[model samples]
Target chain A: MKKKLIVKKNFLMSLFAVILGLIAGAILMFVTGSNPIEGFYYLFRGGLMNIERIGNSLATATPLIFAGLSVAFAFKTGLFNIGGAGQMLIGGLCATAVGLTFDWPKPILLTVIIIAAMIGGALWGALPGLLKARFNVHEVVATIMMNWIAYWTVFYLVPLYLKGPFLETESQRIPMAASLKVSWLTSLFSGSYINLGIFLAIIFVAITAFILERTTLGYELKAVGYNRDAAEAAGIGVNRNIVLSMAVAGALAGLGGATFYVGFASNMQIGVLPSQGFDGIAVALLGANSPWGVFAAALFFGLLHTGKGFMNAMTAIPPEIADTIIATIIYFAATSVLIERNWDKLNKFRLALRLRKSKQESLEDDSGGEQ
Target chain B: MVDLIYQLFPYAIAFTVPLLITSLGGLYSERSGVINIGLEGLMLMGMFVGALIISRTESIYPGTAIWIGLLAAMLFGAVFALLHAFACVTLNANQVISGIAINMIAAAVTVYLARLISGSGNIQIIRGLSRQTIPILSDIPILGRLLFTQTYATTWFVLLILVVATFLLYKTRFGLRLRACGEHPHAADSAGVNVYRMRYMAVIISGACAGLGGATFIVTISGEFNGTAAGLGFLALAALIFGQWKPWGILGAAFFFGFASTVANVSQVVPMLAQIPGIYLKTFPYVVTLAALVLSSKYSLAPKAIGEPYDKGKR
Candidate 1:
């Protein structure tokens, strides 16, 4: 690959956002009367210093990766897939239900559960897409309502059918046969919770990249996103593409649900909508809505999350404030488009200044030659 | 049946007042061509600030502190919402994304600040608004028994706001200008309206009202702030949409959701609703909202340029 000092446009912009986010986080630490350098040092050390921490970071990043892709993919097709949490919930619920109920062989059951999760998530996702496409209803409201629906569904169903031995809040743990952890993988990682989900996440990353960059479906979807009326006038079925994009987005988040409830940790808990779903929005924005960009952004966010507890333990800053730092980072990341726009304007101003200097220099040369 | 009706109605009104106020707040922002999904965060800001004020002043003013809390909540809510306003309105950020950031930040910041102030994450409001009977209205038979008896002073205050909000939205030149900005901002500009200023003012006002709603929530329901409005902001947004972006329509929607929420909260307390599962009751409003969005949205008429950032150069 040819190397450039600034790299690509979206990646460069995202890098700027990341740097800005870190500086903002540091400022927050400073404001709270903590040493920013010391805080950041331990934060990185917590997520990367040990093999277990590395494995744990990758494990934590797994769901975020899928959720980011879900949001990013739909974004490419002009759909804001804010329902990642609901899709993840429904997907996790279906996967857990399958994992606990089935007695099938390992590969078969895992495959079945994964497929069920994708389907369940797809249904939840496509509903809002369909409404937006057909009726012009806003996706944000529909998806938010769907989140509550999924929340209540899991809250209701877990206790009624999947209750564990002691806890009324969580579903029964998955049996070893249906679990995502292979003995070799666990040993290779030295007893970490990192499972098959990480590999699957990498594979899906490549698959999404191919689907987005190399397919006619991707072209059609992008055409719709760029201008729906123009796409429709050009003979593209904008409505179909919208729903299809959301389904694909939902499928990715569904896989993440499998990663979370079955792979990283077993059993679904009631009452809490997965914060990863909202975090996906930040990830997607920071990544500039690209699949590979989302992968990197998710890993970065994973480091922040994994390192946070350690950052808290070593400093006067409490965990709640640490969480506030993460949120502040997200707040800045979301406004990165502002930074990008300003950067573009600044570039234009520089180009104009350079042209004016060149014009003045040529005029001076002409005058000197005449003299 | 009358007794059951009597019991649920007062509870429903208590619930309705906040939802109504919040939805009205949302209406101002949405009507000015900005989507204020920050209502949730704004509400949380109100709850946090209001509860903080009430907690800190519990000893100083003891009896009148809750009213002071209400004022502090509105001011603080508007202040925090200024971040969102600056992002979406001035910087031309994606309104939904900005709103989501505001919501996430509000939850975290409130908890963090509460922890810093009280040395714990939880901020408790020792005193809250007590239910009061309107002396003359309480003796007026059906109306008094149904609407005036055993209600918080907040119910009347919110009602007064609703009437004022409706009058201002329909009868004032400012409302017309705000509505014009939402529908056709370029046209409004050509008509010599300051679209940007109107939107900013509407959003700030929206934040203030939502904060007041949050104050009412803690005052009427929780009696304490633990860093969430429990999705009441989203429910307010839902009411804004369900009411078809009109004041009367939003009131009806808020009333419906309020009753549904009351049912969910009071299911165990009420003998008839106790037999139903808690999950179903909790899920009812969401399901109904989704169905309503699906079935009625085709006929819905939103402000023409609602979610887009206005560019002076663009046609």
Candidate 2:
């Protein structure tokens, strides 16, 4: 019971936010004259009703898990990495380029592709880090700018080098050797788009959690996040950590990009920076910046997106309205800082009252025994 | 050359107004110790509201829809910004996260509402504002022809806003206190300025300016709100950085972007410009903005205490 309480306390705030988000979504549904309970019923059912849907949700969550980790990892180092979008794009681009050009054995090719994606993303992330560390250039503005640069780079590269026979807006379809999907896995999932990325995401989640919880590096990074000046005074290399943190973030986002372009999608599309990049921010926040929590949050978001179509089809709610509800929930979840502060205050207050009560009871017992 | 000037100058002014006003909007917020990265989202909100009002009420009030829409946009912007103000100032939420949330809300709300009302994502104005030349100014020489001819009344409104904003920023008591709060809120608090109130007011004013700018875009230039300001808000943010948060410098930067946008738009009409690929032309301004940011960020004089939520109890 005690252990359960402690576990609940650790995740209680995030769970509260989730419940509040659901209530907000329900309110929107009710206001729109639909039954909120029914709306949610179908929504969850669509994502989990069958083996195929479950497989699809997990597949959809694969990239989001990486994206969430990317954002969360940076948050631990006192950095707001809004450039995840650009990093993801560049990462995807590199992966696509390698996949399209090279012919090698599956193991070597996949390894090379993943490494290339990580490098591309790391380079993109490192620029903003260097700028912020060296030049005092605000990372937010620099990353926003970098997003556009990546956008145009993909825009130019797609049509110029890897255009398909019919479409001008996307690259050529990645061949079977370059793809992440295998015949046996597809068959097991009954023709779902499930791939190797899900397993990779799970392994990385465990790795990231281990790094953050059990390692000296993560401790130093967290210290930097808590107080940069204090950490600097304590002899931590502040600038190096900032850069290293961002590079790791970028690499994580790059892995997400690879999962997306190579595993889930057959070809790379132009003219869009992936929405998953931005969703990563929501995922990180919702997960309370925990690696395992990010996995769960990402899975939830994947369920929403995967089930969104069913909700639209079954109810009077339009797709745009559904999206509005989700974004509203995100808007509320983004206020987790305030919620966290309040929760901390409440805990302290409760602890203080309990201590006073125990002290008075002990004094009373002593008096009765003496009498 | 004459043809180029004639073609490009008017469009430049039209495009420049939003960038100028939005950056000025950013200036107010940042100068008052609040970092508002949601200017893009706020502008989108104003644009969609203004467009919706005009489109729906064109039949009811054809003569006054545009002006009414502008005011409506401003009102909507203030209300929306109140949410941001509440989050950042009162709740002490992470400013960047809140700003991003505000942006997501705006993007989501506008598209959903537009589709809900218009049965489509895009909202088109029935009649766009026409150009008006100043009566006495039209009779003047080459200067008048270059400046006054074939321009919307919002052009003059933009100039008026620029002057008033400059005056209010530099020459007023409130302005001094606002600047003081941004520089050192504790000092301002010691001097009897309410730091929270000042920051809140500054954010609201930022909203109003962004609203007017967004209305100008819908009323004069685009004649439609397509659920996006086409990233003009981010450009305005770039201008704010490039301008070093000065009014005149912001105007100059706004004009530079405005000219670039005009070049992008008029390339279809101009013979020399038509040779370039459409994609290249589209990407030019964004690339230039990035370059400008990289250069300008090196010398930026941003407010000292900006992005820090002022806590009065902290020494």
Taking all chains together, each candidate's TM-score versus the true structure is: 0.95, 0.93
Residue lDDT tens for model 1, A1-371: 33352346567777776676677667767887788899888888878888778888898899999999999999998888888998999999999999999999999999999899999999989888888888877888888888888988898889999999999999899998777878888887788778899999999999999988899999999999999999999999999999999888888998899899999888889878898898888888877787888899899888877887787777766555445655666677667767778878887899999999999999999999999
Report how far off residue B38 is in candidate 1 (Å): 1.5
Candidate 1 chain B weakest ten by summed lDDT: B112-121
lDDT of each: 0.85, 0.84
Q: How well is candidate 2 docked (DockQ)?
A: 0.51
> Looking at every candidate separately, what fraction of the true A–B Cα contacts under 8 Å does it contain?
0.68, 0.46
* Pairs that collide, model 1: none
DockQ of every predicted complex: 0.65, 0.51
Which candidate has the top score in DockQ? 1
Q: State, as a TM-score between 0 and 1, how close model 2 is to the true structure.
A: 0.93
Q: State which candidate has the highest TM-score.
A: 1
Candidate 2: where are CA atoms >4 Å away? A1-10, A103-106, B135-142, B265-271, B274-300
Badly placed stretches (over 4 Å) of model 1 are A1-7, A353-371, B118-120
Model 2: which docking level applies? Answer: medium
